[model samples]
Target: MNTALDPTGATAAYLAKLPKGAVETAAHYTQGSHWVLVIGKLAAVVACLIILRSGILPRIAAMTGSRNRQNFAVFATGFAALLLQALLLMPWTFYADLVRERSYGLSNLTTGAWLTQSFITAVAGALVGGLLFIPLYVIIRRAKQRWWMWSSALLALLIALATVFAPYAAGLFNRYEPLQPGVVHDVVTDLARQASLSGEEIVIYDGSKQTDRYTASVTGVGGTARIALSDTVMRDPVDIPAIRAVVAHEIGHYKHHHLLILAGAVALLSCIGLIMAAFAFPTALRLLGGGGVGGISDASGIPVLLAISAVFTLVTTPVVNTVMRLVERDADAYGLNLAREPDGAARALLATTSYRAPSPSRLEEVIFYDHPSIESRLRVAMEWKAAAQGR
Candidate 1:
């Protein structure tokens, strides 16, 4: 079964089709984001520090002055702290999300659209914070020493809810319609059948209104599950193979229960983080708490807890990313086997270079990438093709 086909050579020839300098330009944009990630974390810490030292939240909480108002106070102070952090990070957010994306020709948003989206996101985040943190504070007050365990359970529930309801939630922002009858639709339906997924779950969303990049995902569980493709991906009839390849990859995620796995992993990490934070809370309270902060249950202590959580997440990023990348690699292999369209998979992976760096050094990928580099994925696809042809 030995084949003379050189997968590496084939992959190189495929990549050589890219416009000169495309890879370098995309790489520069992505590499710069590593700095942005570091700066953003620092800014969040500084923002929390300001809130801790300012005594603003404690003053607001004190204004509640009634046992009945404690829950409301939690929401109010947590919402305020979140808003303040967002405000502090706004400059960096604007630069990184909009200006930088526009410079790289990746963003399709106008300033007005960006502002509208940002405002909507901010409002939604504040609402969710109010809903989440109020109950969180209640847990802290009642559970006391065991709050970390209870809080982790609550976090796990929220993660499950978020994952299951993601498609419906996304519809609030983007218009989704069932894909029309066509070659792409036919291919997607066939793939869905092979994967034993509901054909009714295939949808197309108007993502071109936001970005020109191709995107697709399978999300939710039970009745809420959907396989959604961005309109950009299906705009051209010739893109059928790429669309098939992407959808197959998404189907692989569903078959492997990657969403559930990721959700569980995040919840587990959060529990670990809370455990660590519980141990570290007292030291942080002493060093950063000042006169405004009282203790873990106090409104002012929220920022300190937040700062601790952010630090923990930053520290665990590489490990988290490595796990995610491995999952993605597994899915890629599954997709190749299921779809038997390695060339199409290779093409789809290459198309992602419109925004993603086609290749990053091993160290760069290890630290920053949650998906395998395109070069690696393409090589694997090529190898799959050669093996299939030989067989």
Candidate 2:
């Protein structure tokens, strides 16, 4: 191999190219990823309207004796739709995450293992959501009149609870026990470091079990800090320097406390939304079924919840993207600082981008990106390299 460096390769880089149309390859068998999300959300929204309009809501309203009985009816109906939507979308989620990953040469999980993993994720989400949300949702109703103040307070409590509960969540959901840190001596020093932490720990969930991509995350509530890397990351994105680059970025999430910040933001927004829903739900309920406004009771709460859900979905996309970009920027720097190899980081971005749209449309990235676009991450990585060499 002539290991010659190009002008573009101001930093030493080595990696292989990715295979073709992995996503399309995935779509050959099942509904596409984007289709699943759009259809799921839209279906859930529509389901909500039908349940409210077909006398179900009025019946619930009549049965409840609370002052905010109408609000409860509307909330319950919307939530039921949400719960169902979550359940129905699980198949699509499996197709994209597990089945397609294997098709495109990424996943290594057998069907039984895949099914077990999916079951774990759902149960974990339900348990964590139930404990944190049941109280929060109950509180929201109690504070309907003082919606913003009490709702925000409740939301904050939930996030804190979630953070504290993260480790337990991971333990319950992770089908495999935490792998020994030395097992990844081939790369992933930072992952190993995080994994070895005393109070908080990391559990590698083998993202490759369903997809070919290497991924790692630290998620949960209070003392519940946990991190995990996929088998894909361990195998495919295994270079020590490149791995460090990614680890730096993952570390940024914790250093910057993204979960806590996101939780607080959700709390504040939800509180305002709770008060607004008291007024907004009625309109949303009516609009849901193309019916007149008068058909809904507690016009106040119904419209607001519907409006809040819509607004949350819309605004959160861009806002969360900006935060991710910022976090990514910081993480790239962390990699550069810790590994002293921006080229490795840049190359890592390129090798993996084959599976994910490396150069997605701005709208696409804004609407959907959970991480920085490959180009954006590369640009930042290059700048860091230039700065490191004092160029």
101 in model 1: Cα distance from truth in Å? 0.6
Q: What value does the lDDT take at residue 223 in candidate 1?
A: 41
- How much lDDT does candidate 1 score? 0.83
lDDT per residue (tens digit) for residues 282-361 in model 1:
88777775566777888768888878888888888888898889889888988888788888888888888877788788
For model 2, what is the error of residue 366's alpha carbon versus the real structure, in angstroms, after optimal superposition?
3.6
Cα lDDT of candidate 2 equals: 0.56
TM-score of 2: 0.70
**Candidate 2's error at 352, in angstroms?**
2.4
The sequence of per-residue lDDT tens digits that candidate 2 reaches over residues 1-391 is 4443342454223222434465345334323445555655565565445544554434444465665544454445444434444565567667766676666666677888777877766555545443443454565556655555665676677766665455455444345457576735435555535434335564566454455665666554444555566656667435766666666666657656776666666666566655666666556654665353343233322322443476555555666656656666666666566666677677677666545665567877776666777766766676676665554
